[model samples]
Target: MDKLTSMNVFVRVAKAGSFAGGARDLDISRAMATKHIMHLEGVLGTRLFNRTTRSLSLTDVGASYLERCQQVLLEVEEMEAAVTHLQTEPRGVLRISAPPVIGSTHIAHAVSEFLKIHSDLTIEMIIQSSPGDLIDEGIDVAIFLGALDDTSMFARKLASSSLVVCGSPDYFEQYGIPETPEDLENHSCLVNWAIAPRNKWLFKGEAGYTGINVSGRMQANVADPIRIAAISGLGLVMLPTYIVGRDIEKGRLKVVLEDYTSPPLDVHAVYPHRKYLSAKVRSFMDFLQEWLEHRVSVIPPVME
Candidate 1:
């Protein structure tokens, strides 16, 4: 068996977390997948996976090796593309990572359109909260919202969405609208840990920028749940306009503190720094930047 082919199989199996799952992805028999693993173990003289009938997991060394294999395969793919003169046109698979809300909505739509233009390109999108280890997971690009914390990766600004503090009309009627950022203290303010400044909401007022350390009976890591809670009249929520735009438009939620403005959440496309950039990644990045800019260019302070 080719060493490179064995490495690819091993990576598939490791990611799938089961030989059957990996074999299914590769369109190979379980026996063939097992053979590939055994072949690699024999060459490396190390046990890559600890297997039981119920589960399969990578060993410490296997975890490290998986990262190396992904990098190697990526380089080989780039080299082949260059040799075939496909460097100018994207071909093969392009893996992406993105936050769930935007990933399923805007980013996914952009990818579908890009694929239409480049029929030879394939895209695999992983909707995840964090970017994770890009190199280890073999992700070509990651769509990030808000500020960039990791300075190691290269990033490009794609677009921005305004943030809004809102709640159900019933809740506002019952609790009374918060007239100022500081007035949030008197009301229940639902918090989403996923967005930056998490428990603290920021706003720009006559006194300049201020951050309010907010707390509520409800809190979540994702924006959707928080949005749902606000719609049900549980509490107020601070979320990006993209997540709560429709709700505001439909009157399921009402925007508050219109006099104050919050910083727009910046959307970014991030990827690991690589010396050789593949046409698939480079072209998609350029396309997505332009696509998102037009789509999310102007997020009104209130969807209405």
Candidate 2:
């Protein structure tokens, strides 16, 4: 049996979790798929799947082998891609993932301009607040804000936006403005639970970086909802300037604690590490860096 072909079939079977499903995906028959798995198990002297009438699942050894198979397949794919497209221009579908607010506001525009420049290239943008598994999703690139927790992936800084603590004038009038980070404890602060550290908001104060535990009636896993709540005078909110800069300019919200700066929100283009990066990924990364630099430069300065 061809080991590489068997590995590919096994991977598809593992991912699909059914012989018929895997066979359909590869355009092969279920009998062929079974033969491949049987060959693999015979060679390894173990069962790869715990088969039953009700369900199909991987055994302990199968789970470990599946991970290695994925890595090998990915490497082989990248190698082939590098050789086939050595001098070819970037063309084909480019998959991207990003936070909803940033994706809709900024990345949408960037992609529009990028597509206009590269006529042969198409884009599939997934607007998700949470960072989903890039490999499982077949995402070519992902736009991330703030610090990245996964160090295994490669990252390139696109731009940075300052975080601002702001509230509606009506809200300030009702609750009074917070004079310091600690004062946030006394005020009802709207929280974007999507951001890390949860209810604890961070700032640079006299004693250096400090986190203030804040509470309010409103909390959400997305930025827009909290922003809407703040605009409606429900509570104070700390958000990136990119989200609230226009609101502040129009006098809908007023930034407080300007003296104490929150950490800058760094935007990044992240991708899985590869020996040879694809032309589509490389070209888009370059385009995004240039696009965002211009975009960030034009943001209206926040008022004191």
**Candidate with the greatest lDDT versus the true structure:** 1
How well is each residue in 1-304 modelled by candidate 1, as lDDT tens digits? 9999999999999999999999999999999999999999999999999988898999999999999999999999999867666667799999999998888888888888898999998899999999989999999899988899999999988889888899999998888999899999888999999877878999997787789999999998888888899999999999888788788878999999988899888999899976668789889999998877766655432222
- Model 2 stretches astray by more than 4 angstroms: 1-88, 297-304
Best candidate according to TM-score? 1
Q: Write the per-residue lDDT of candidate 2 for residues 129-209, one digit (tens) a residue.
A: 855888989998999887899998888999987788999999999989998889999998999986768998999877887
Candidate 1: list runs displaced more than 4 Å. Answer: 1-84, 206-208, 300-304
Model 1: ten consecutive residues of lowest lDDT: 295-304
Reference-based TM-score of each model: 0.70, 0.70
Report the C-alpha displacement of residue 295, candidate 1, in angstroms: 2.5
Each candidate's root-mean-square deviation in Å? 17.6, 15.7
TM-score of 1: 0.70
